[model samples]
Target: MEDAKPMLLVLSLLVVAILPTLRANIADFDEVWKKRAEDAKKASLEAYDPHPERVTQNVNEEVHEALEGDDGKRRNLKKYNGPCTATNPIDRCWRCDQDWASNRKKLADCALGFGRKATGGKDGEIYVVTDPSDDSLLDPKPGTLRYAVLQPQPLWIIFAHNMMIKLSQELMVTSNKTIDGRGANVHIANGGQITLQFVRNVIIHGLHVHDNKAGNGGMIRDSFDHFGLRTRSDGDGISLFGATDVWIDHISMWNCQDGLIDAIMASTAITISNCHFTHHNEVLLFGGSDTYSDDKVMQVTLAFNHFGKGLVQRMPRIRWGFVHVVNNDYTHWLMYAIGGSQQPTVISQGNRFVAPPSLFAKEVTKRGYTPESVWKSWNWRSEGDLLLNGAFFVESGSPITNLDTKDMIPAKPGSFVARLTRFAGALACVKGKPC
Candidate 1:
């Protein structure tokens, strides 16, 4: 019995000594299994890789090819050569002081001819003051001219004051005239209640409409008084109130009370492109009144534009419409990209969203905000929303089957440059200039 006891003790001691070594081996085996699992996951992802650069190139090529005809030609030419500069001959002479430099006899004859032309002959041609300066030809009283020329018709109406001379509540633009700003500054100051009501096929291009202290008491009031002054407009920058086929391009608006641009009441086929809209409450608004369900589909396209900063909630509060918001850079702001009610079909694609921290990080600690809060505020559901390198947010249950990060084109630091490069050739062709 004594001999058996010593043998048992020695065996127990050996087992105890080896138990630690066995545990170490098991741990080692577990670590190897974990590494294999991770490696398999990585390999699986790599198998379905979508090359980003290749996709970007494909998109760029397709855009360029599509814009190669019609508008593309004008765009290319304008890029290489600036806009054409042409004006009336009399205006050019007056500008050069060539008319003033001539001798007294020629000047007198010129002045007489000008007067005779201003006053109609005995044939009852009915002389009307077409030019603002031609008010001298009248009896020199307010509202005394036989006929006041509307806008953009008289070649002498180059500046804003000239256009404002006949700007009235009852003033109706009955003629087809092109009011070219000539890339110059046209200011409307204290012009009382100007409205572009019942005008068609009007193109107000390359003009800066600002600081018109026009009291909102006449026939037309500022759009801001009716609608809140969140956007950069005293009234609205350009109100297409019951107008159609209006094209507003290449204009910059800031520091006004209402929306930068407002299209209301059955305005159809409105195209707002290549314009910078900032420092406002709402950049672009559609469907002020819901009268006709058929016209609700006004078909507004907001493309190749920059919308951000100096304002909170800068999205188009669209109701009842098909709005295609594509290729825009939306960064540095608050609230929804688009928020409104009704059966509005919003096609929001190809946009870069740089959230607070990142989509992947567990927590985002910046400006005392969190990932959860940011996601909620932006109406982003993380579970459904896909994250590409910690950016971009699509709606939950979206029809987007796949958002392969590998297929995403890498952008530069700022969203503006990224968007430009993404849709560079198309924008260049559309704007008639290099992007």
Candidate 2:
């Protein structure tokens, strides 16, 4: 342990004294927090109010128009202009495809961060998961989801029909694979888990994954070439281990045995977008722990998601990584929304957080058992975010001065969060319906 007395003094002077004023610039904290609560209520109403324009134009044109203006706060959007116009930058990359199934590879091109180029079977053949049974954990048949993911080659896996698949054990996913459940209703529920280990270039999209349980590990086939034994799984909906270039999008997850999504062992370049999470304790965990300091390479983008109902903490709890949490709706949480340790850099923008009724849990963050002094030095920042319902973000670390952070489009505002995260969950896209 360090000599923390001096650090404690700084924490008291900066965080305890000056921090409150910097957060809201008000003398009475309750008054300002009350005002924020009212504002959040108003914003929530406006968010849920029916917007006719949504039916007319699929995307929010005002947001796009705002970015187009020469007000000089447009960020770097001009680089992907013309055809690539969306309210959310990540959506602009892939959602334009009405023919998304035919051009499924386009999703890989739309990713940002360390996982930008995760093609996941973009160059391979289509494999349909006609069977939902995981009866044969080893040497699964071609029609099952397990078998489709195990093939070593790049493959696009799609469900043949609406089905809820229960796995006897965790499904070990191989590299260069895309499991796309867009056109059909698919659920990986009833004690099923998916693991990505020592692989690259994978994409998982538009699936409801929940009700997972700990796996009593046995013979599991990881790839077409090899079969291996494993330890017990923690029942994470998706676990990334020593993997890179992974993109998971448009997922709905809840009530997992562990973190809904856990990325450990130096997984980098990943994006988790347009997802919904609920009824979980620990939601997302990035990096392994404090001892795994080499996880400094982790760069992740969490965008356009909805954290709704019955959540506790770790909307992502991070350690030794740079996490970008942008343009999402956080409707409720029992404990805290975001937390971390090991001096991670967290950038939160263009989001809305409506706190739960508990007074003690009003704050939106938690420092993982570190003394105030050490945690205060971490670069945790909030810009253009809407903190409502008396929800306040306790920020520390250095002010954002760089151009990349300076020119942020400020989409994380509370008003914009509703529209930005309007489409958070699995879609019931019929053949010709807008997804």
- TM-score of structure candidate 2: 0.79
TM-score list, all predictions: 0.46, 0.79
Give the lowest summed-lDDT range of ten residues in model 2: 49-58
Q: Mind giving the per-residue lDDT tens digits that candidate 2 earns over 128-246?
A: 99988888877898799988988878998988899999888888787789999988999999775888765677899989999999887777666676665555677889988656778
Model 1 weakest 10-residue run by lDDT = 111-120
Runs of candidate 2 with Cα error greater than 4 angstroms are 1-87, 93-96, 402-409
| C-alpha lDDT of residue 131 in model 2 | 88
Cα misplacement distance, residue 133 of candidate 2 (Å): 1.0
Quality of model 1 by C-alpha lDDT:
0.36
Error of 1 at 46 (Å): 52
Cα RMSD for candidates in order: 27.9, 15.7
- Candidate 1, after superposition: displacement of residue 238 in Å? 1.1
Candidate 1 backbone collisions, by pair: 75-432, 190-213, 229-257, 230-281, 232-256, 233-256, 233-257
